[model samples]
Target: MPLCFQELVTPLLIDGAVSPLSPQSPLSASFTSVLPYHKDSGILSEAEAKKAQKALADGNLLEVVFAAIETLRRVPSTRVNIAVTGDSGNGMSTFINALRGIGHEEEASAPTGVVRTTQTRASYSFSCFPDVVLWDLPGMGATSQSLEDYIVEMQFSQYDLFIIIASEQFSMNHVMLAKAIEEMGKKFYIVWTKLDMDLSTRMLTEGQLMKNIRENILENLQKTRVRKPPIFLISSLEPSWHDFPKLRDTLKEDLSDIRYHGPLQNLFHAYKEIINDKVTYLQEKIATNSFQNTPGMRDIDDLAECLKTYRLSFGVNDESLQQLARSMGKESSEYKAIMKSQDLQAVITRGWKLKCLTCRVMKMFLILLSYIPSLDALIAPYIRQEKHNRMLEGVAEDTMTVLKKVLKDFTSS
Candidate 1:
């Protein structure tokens, strides 16, 4: 399976010998302490933490984490299909060409002209988005076929997004297409093309012309019972002007939403599953090995190492952050500045002696509690598991932060 965002960092989190399973373990002591502050940390709700603890006791932690990782590995291969359709002379082909960031005369450009150029559906790959495919369907009402028949023939259900183009005024065909797309529960945008021609012929000012066109389109769409569909007015001859830039940005944002809902949803679920499973695994470990001894310098060192690994695994390490900066066209320092978990190593190292002192105090406390009958058996495990859960929660939050930043950069690009 492909490497998940969590998998890439799991090795770092689990590396080195700190368990009693290895007698020659580098750790100085079996340091286990359930700090009191973790109880109200809000890492996991009481119900959820109890559920995970139960799962751990049942020995099903590995199975759960593995299943979630498998689901996350499928996200990169998800495909997105977008369909662009309109009347023959409404500049659908030109819009497709412009969207692909190429001139109409370019070899890879979609053919555009006064005549019906796209006789059959053609697919084009977006250079910036490897998994996205754009389909240019022949104009509606080009032949004897009705609009409904044309939609069926084009297999409209295959596309995730639709762009319906119109020239001069919003026609019945545009409204029908918008309504059909809306009914199908898909997203569609209306593009008013040939705006330059209207500006030249109409008596209204540019602002008034755009306002009238937008109001008219919205009015027509309302009649068809299509609510709040995005509308853009632009001259194919001057796509950089008017609403073209806004159109591009809005489409990218909408596509980002579709992409997230399609595959990222699975990844998100997997993330939650892995987090819960990790909590369960840690709770099991704490239950199995508690009140053994006081943690010394070696235990503190091991924890510091673990913190370093956590940072690296989540792509927040200095090297990883630098590489991400280069890929996103930002400075490395900018990423480091925004990253909340970058001080993991420093926090561990700077507070080492104090942490060690606290661990020794916790060990003494556990020893005293053990004398108080059943309190040690019940309270020690719960406290330790809560502390472990809080640590894991911080790591999970950092992972999500990095993932969101990467995704935003990708979609915007």
Candidate 2:
């Protein structure tokens, strides 16, 4: 179903049941909401916008992820195209092979050589990461094309992320590439590959050498005013040794965010626009209509009812979530996993919105609005719209979260 605000408040369940989430504290019975994003910063960057709905339809993982999403989100399959680049002979191809658990001799492994074996851009993939393509772009060297020329030739804008590889020492090429990538508002990592060669030097012990390498890379980046990103010290040949595993694991872990970054932002933006329009309409309708006998603002049951409203809106209350869990063949409690906070402040403030009613704030806001009849004849009507809109948004976000988990469950191995 194409997502619409009206469909929600009264949604027809999709073909499949979706999935779960987090923590606990004193459940405050108040109407508080976390708006997804602000108006000015809401829209995604150009690059991210290109990665979503439009591009996902053509992405490699679409068939599988699209099907799963149809049952819940109906959005596109997220893709993360990572470009691994460096000067010739920096083991860029070797790193790609290692990351995919393949050797140079294996089929589809990125070609490696003492010279520039990667003549043009080539890509590799790993199982369960169909949407993640590791591009083995032709190496950039001082004697070769200029940085500007190389960037255009490589179509740098197409890659979602970058991995700048270096060995022996940090070069001006690497530093320049990193700075350029950063300037473009993209994330890049400094992977000091060939760790074996760097470690062989006798001047420093292993730990000292590692620290020295990190400092040297850091210093080079610092001079150029480049943001220090995760710098991995790894030997592509010995993948399991050094930081190769950590780098790979980190890369894999980051894909979750990388994948959803575009689609989720687009979805959130669209949802926000829909909700904003609804809030405006609701505010007007509420100001005119008779909202009879909503328990007096002072009633304690009003707080309880409001809490239930919020919970039911998000489909997070115990009974509904339990039924969802059961329908999905999952443990009901799994959907409500709580992480106990040991911090006193956090423990006390946790769920403060769910447990306590902020009636005073509501009353005060209404009293203030009461002075402005031009705003609303009945201040309570405006507050009702405020509460309903906030609750609607919270519900929308929770729905997106569940959709994400469900997609993950279907896509991940």
Q: Which window of 10 residues has the lowest lDDT sum in candidate 2?
A: 1-10
Candidate 2 lDDT score at position 262: 63
What is the lDDT for 377 in model 1? Answer: 74
Backbone Cα, N, C clashes tallied per candidate: 0, 9
- Which numbered prediction scores highest in lDDT against the true structure? 1
How does candidate 2 fare on TM-score? 0.60
Model 2 C-alpha lDDT versus the unseen true structure: 0.59
- The sequence of per-residue lDDT tens digits that candidate 2 reaches over residues 183-205 is 99998899988878877765778
| Model 1 TM | 0.52
lDDT of 1 at 60: 30
Score every model by TM-score: 0.52, 0.60
Backbone clash tally (model 2): 9
